[model samples]
Target: MDKTQNPNNNEMVIDLVDLAKALWRRAWAIVLVMVIFGGAAFGYARFLVTPLYQASAMMYVNNSSINVGSTQVDLNDLTAAQSLVETYIVILKTRGTLEQVIEEENLPYDYETLSGMIEAGAVNSTEVFEIQVTSADPEEAERIANCVAEILPDRIAEIVEGSSVKIVDYAIVPSQKSSPSISRYTLLGLLLGAVVSCGIIVLLYLFDDQIRDEEYVRQTFDLPLLAAIPDLTGKNSGSSYYYSKKTSGKEATP
Candidate 1:
C-alpha cells in the first residue's frame, strides 16, 4: 500500500488517543484525586486564610477656580488636573501622611503595613481618583478610609501651595470580603490535581515496553503476522497446538 508523504518519518511521539484512553481508564481515580485536592484547597481558603474587606473613598483634584456660567472650559486645566494626580499620589503615599492617619485613628499598624493595605489610583485617566483601604474588619477599613479622606485634603493643601483635593464621596463599610477567594482556590487545586495525575499516567504509558498481544507486536516491532488461531477448549489462555503422534508400528484402527 502507498503511504502519503510525511516530513517526520523517524520521529516517534506518544499517541494522543492512547494517552486519552489511559486517562479515561482511570477516570474514577482522577475525579477522586481532584475532589481531595479541591476540598483541601477549599478548607484552607475558607478556614485558615484571613479574609480582608475593602472600603473606598473618592476625591476630586481641583486645579483652578472655574468661573460661573462659563460657556467654554480650558482643556489645559483638565490636563493639569490629570497631571497633578501623580504628585498627589506621591504625597498621599508618604510616611508623614500615613503617620498622621495612624495617630488620628490610633491604629496598631506601622507605616509600611498601613501603606500596603492602601491603594490609590486615578479614575479612568480623569481628575477623580479613588482611595481604598483594606482591613480584616470592614468597620476598621471604613474608619481608615474616612480618616484619610478627612485628613488628606488639608495635608495636600498645606504641602502644595495652590493645589487642593475635595472629597467626592466618603468611605462606607464594606459588606463583602475582598480577598481569600474559595472558589478560585478550589478550581486551581482541581486543575493542579488533574495535571499531575494525567502527567504521571502519560509518562507511564510512554515508557512502558511490555508486550500485550500480537497486534501490539505488529504495530510496535513492524513484524508480519504468520498465523492466528481462535480460543479452544473454552480456556481463556494463550495459543497452544495439539497433534496426535504418528502410528509407526501399530496398524491404523479406523
Candidate 2:
C-alpha cells in the first residue's frame, strides 16, 4: 500500500496554499458580490432603521443597615434579594414608572409604547445596577432614565424600611447618544458578510469539477504542459507575444 494513501498522512491533507490559489483565481467575482451586498446592508442599517438613543444611570446597593437579630443574610436571603432586585427592575419598566415619568416630563407618547424602549440590568460582581431608557428623542431617554433611577430606590426602601435608602451615585444627564453604533454595526456586518461569502466560495470551489487549472488539463489529457495561456486581459497587458506564441504552438499540433 502507498504511504500517501493513509488518511492520517499530512501529505494527503488539503493545503492552505492550494486553497488560497483557488480563492485568488475567483477573487474578482467574490469582491464584486461582497461589495454589492455589504453596501446594501450598510445603507439599510444606517438610513432605513430607526435610531434609538440610550441614557443610563448606575446605582450601587451597599446593604448598609445590618440587623443585630438577623445579623448576616444567608445564601437563600441573598438569592431572594437578587430575585427581588430583578423583579423591581421589571416593575421599574412598567406603566407605573413610565406614567410618573410622562406626567413629570410631559411626554408625547403613551405609557405602554414609551416603556417598551426602557431596559434595566444589574452589574456583575457588584450590587450596582443600571436603568437605561431608550427613545428617538435624546431628552426623553435622559428624563426617563433619571426618573426611574430616582423613584426606584425610594420605592424599594419603603418596602424594606421606614427611611429612604442611601443613593451611592446620582443619575447624570447623558450628552451622547448610545444606539445605532455606526462604526461597530457597519464593521460587524462587513466582517459577517465577508466570512459567509468566503465560506460559500470555498464550498463552491470544493464541489466544482470544472477544468480551470493547467494541472487538470495535464492529468485529464496525459499531456506535457509546454506553456500556459493566461486570461486574455492579463495577456494584453504586457505578455501578448509570449501567450500568442503558446496558443499558436497548441494550434499547430496535430
Candidate 3:
C-alpha cells in the first residue's frame, strides 16, 4: 500500500494559510461590511439612542442610642450600623419611599418606572449606603438622588424608630452622559462586523468547490502534474495560471 494512501494522510485539512488567502480574496467585502456596521453603531449612539445621566448620593447609618455622646464610638455600635445598612437599602426601594419621591419631585413616571431607575446598595460591608438615580435629564437624576437621600432618612427613622441616617455626600448634576457609550458601541460594532464578515468568507470558501490551484488538484486526485496554462486575462495575466497533465512524461508550459 502507498504510504500517501493512508486514510489519515489523505484526509483534507484546512489551515491558516488557506484562511488567510480566503480573507485576502474577500478583503474589500469585509472592509465594506465593517464600515457599514461601525457607521450604523456610531449613528445610533450619537443620534438615535437617548443619553442617560447618573447621579449618586451616599448616606451613613448611625444605629446607636440617641443618648450616646458623639465623641464616644463603640465597636458594637459600628457592627450594628453595618448590619442595619442592608435593611435601609431595602426600605429605600420600598413603594412608600418611591411614591413619596415621585410626589415630591412631581416626576412624570410611575412607581415601577422610577424604581427601575433607582439603585440602592450598601458600600461594601460598611455602614454607608449609596443611592443612585439614572435619567435622561442630568438635573433630574441629581434631584431624584438627593430627594431619595433626604426622604430615606425619615423613612428609616420611621421603620427602625431610633436609627440615624445622615447624608455623607450629596448628588451633583453630571456633566457627561453615562449611557449610549459611543466608544464601547463602536468597538462592539467593529467586533460584530469582523465576526459576520469572517463567517461569510468562511461560508463562501466552503461552498466554492471549484479547483483553484495545482496543489488542490494534485491532493484531490493523487496525480502528478505535467504542464501549466497561463491565464492571459488583462487584470492578472502576470500572476494567475493553471496546471494540466500532458500525455508525455515531460513537463510543458504555456
The prediction achieving the highest TM-score against the true structure is 1
Q: List residue ranges in candidate 1 displaced over 4 A.
A: 1-11, 223-254
In order, candidate lDDTs are 0.81, 0.62, 0.81
lDDT of 3: 0.81
Which 10-residue window of candidate 2 scores lowest in summed lDDT? 1-10
Per-residue lDDT over 26-136 for candidate 2, one digit per residue giving the tens place of the 0 to 100 score:
777777766776777778778987877777787655343434378577775455445555666766776666787778777787977777877777878345577777777
Task: Estimate the overall C-alpha local distance difference test score of candidate 2.
Answer: 0.62
Put down candidate 1 lDDT per residue, 1-254, tens digits, no spaces: 11111224744555667778878999887888889889999999999999999999999998765554778878887888898998998899999999999998999999999999999999999999999999999999999999998889888988997778899999999999999999999999999888877788777776776544555544553444444454576665665332222333222110
The full ranking of all candidates by lDDT, starting with the best, is 3, 1, 2
Tally clashes: model 2.
Answer: 0
Q: What is candidate 1's CA lDDT for residue 193?
A: 84
Q: How much is the lDDT of residue 85 in candidate 3?
A: 87
Note the residue pairs that clash in candidate 2: none
Q: Which candidate is the best by lDDT?
A: 3
Cα distance off (Å), candidate 3, residue 130 = 1.0
